[model samples]
Target: MTTDRLTSILNGIGKEISNRQLASILTTGLESFVAEDQAILRTGLAPAPYISASHAHRDGITTQIGGERFSVFRTGRSKSRLNFLSLLRAGHEDYIVNDAALDYMRQRKVAPDVIARLAGHPETSFCSQMAWYDHLVRLRQDVFDPSLVREVSEAAIWGAVRDHGLMGNTVVVSDDAGQFRIPNHALCWVHAERLLQKLMPKTPEQTRKLEAIRDEICASTAI
Candidate 1:
């Protein structure tokens, strides 16, 4: 396919699928290019070796674009599903890597085989440690320690007060000003019901009540 056509297809695929999935499709499409003679190879360089079906479904890969490790969720490998959770956690944003070795060659001047070799290099593995450090630093800067604990507490409290009113206010005091102050009763009742189910013997009446609350919560959060 012409570069413009391929680019258009890829852009469309990116909108519908994860990057890893898109990469896999692109790689498969380029397999013929790789198998051809030098004359044909000159026309279309091989897809990045990293973009393989074999590597499609590995775990511990992050979905973050700049993440050193490739995430199956972001990459759309067989192992990880597209993380809808990420959508809830963070808003939509395009994740792209335009400066990778092969891409550079495609746009600028470079030896094709060299580009192929570079694309296949295990650079991601080498950079993972640095990526992890950067992640930690970002977390430290953005998330307050108390806020983390407070979120946990809040989840718990939400469970606790779903049925019964507040026992006490759940306060999350940050190192800085402006504490996360929540009323005791805003706790998720459904969570508490689940805990109760695990802890206590379930009578038919209790089971029905718990199921009703759980269903209600599930309906409210339906996405």
Candidate 2:
């Protein structure tokens, strides 16, 4: 039997195929490419990244990677939902383009025009933003912001994912800020539930609403 015909019959509308029934059909799908080796799932995060069977990470992949022995299998979920998580090394490590690390160039006896190029121009908003960003990078190392780190990590990850053969059938269904930028993109509704799950609803109405939303998400994402 052809893989496509088998998939067509399994996924046909009004066609309910049980897992055991599909034993003859290979259980593998596009997601298997990554899940087979790198699908280390830890949940309790915003629904955007959550698949169904997820475990929450008390510590985080970041802390685990700190030790001399960084094992991908042992790396767990992050306590903070905003945290950047990945199985790869060198995440936004450079934090910016051009490994050129220059600091406080104004103190030197360089010419005014030379400084003009390095320093941001007031008119150019992009230039100013970069200057501000560079200044922040020069700050202390403990300044780890998950959102910002994810922003950088996403760019690197996107490049690698595209360059490698992870496209076509492989669709990254995530509601995270940047997953849609990938080649094959899709969004998951369950992430909305994650946000509600984290909230401490005050009123009874809010509690009821939260429960309703979660129920809907569970139905959508669950098998």
Candidate 3:
């Protein structure tokens, strides 16, 4: 729930309450719960990983565009969905390689392309070839192996969750490759049924049995 809506409900719907009054009213029970000066509420919930074979959702839209979503909410307007991009720097920041790093990369043939801000430019300044992927892959060649990368990424995700104070209460999720890796997660029935779906039945009887089992699982899950 948003603060403005909560404030309206507290005072009265459509009430004109000042920000100072709202802040004081909202913190009425601070002594009972809050111990620190900070009180954040988000993450480990929104922008969580999606590990489905068929994820035809807006999450797919953002991921395909190389955006790491930080906030996703409807604004109740024409353009409603909001998202944040933390790891989508085009080529300007840390991904901008230093000359020594470039020389080292050149020596190892692990070089990224020099990019241009605009067309019709004579010279090029250095930027990542594939953004963050290139950085990880470059590191993979030297330090981080694939397994290490996965571990590090998982750690980073959880760290982000903590940073946002999403884990202060509790986090729950359904089992899927990326989504289920949280601290407290549970198995999802649909994902579990994918196991049976993967089977290549050699006979009609086997296929029939598998279908029946899948149906039963779905019906049970619905309950």
| Global lDDT of each candidate | 0.33, 0.39, 0.39
Q: Which stretches of candidate 1 lie over 4 Å from their true place?
A: 1-60, 64-200, 221-223
Residue by residue across 1-223, what tens digits does model 2's lDDT show?
Answer: 6555665677786667765556655554646654443433211111222221123344554222111121234344552322332322122222222111112122223334533443343321112234535543553212277444344333333333323322324444555443133333444566666677689989999999888878877886664
Query: How many pairs in model 3 have backbone atoms within 3 A of each other, for residues 3 or more apart or on separate chains, i.e. clashes?
Result: 0
- Please give the range of 10 consecutive residues that has the lowest summed lDDT in model 3: 76-85
Clashing pairs in 2: 43-55, 47-191, 48-191
Segments in model 2 whose C-alpha atoms lie over 4 Å from true places: 1-55, 58-74, 77-85, 88-149, 173-223
Pairs that collide in candidate 1 are 20-75, 21-75, 61-71, 157-187, 158-187, 158-188, 159-188, 162-189
| Candidate 1 C-alpha lDDT tens digits along 1-223 | 4445665676877655555665577667674553443223212212211111112224443232111122222333322212322211122122211133134234334445543543443432212224423432443422245433223222322322221222123221111111111221132344444565674436988778777867776785452
* TM of each candidate vs. truth: 0.19, 0.26, 0.31
lDDT for model 2, on a 0 to 1 scale? 0.39
The full ranking of all candidates by TM-score, starting with the best, is: 3, 2, 1
- How much does candidate 2 score in TM-score? 0.26
Comparing 1 and 2 on TM-score, the stronger one: 2
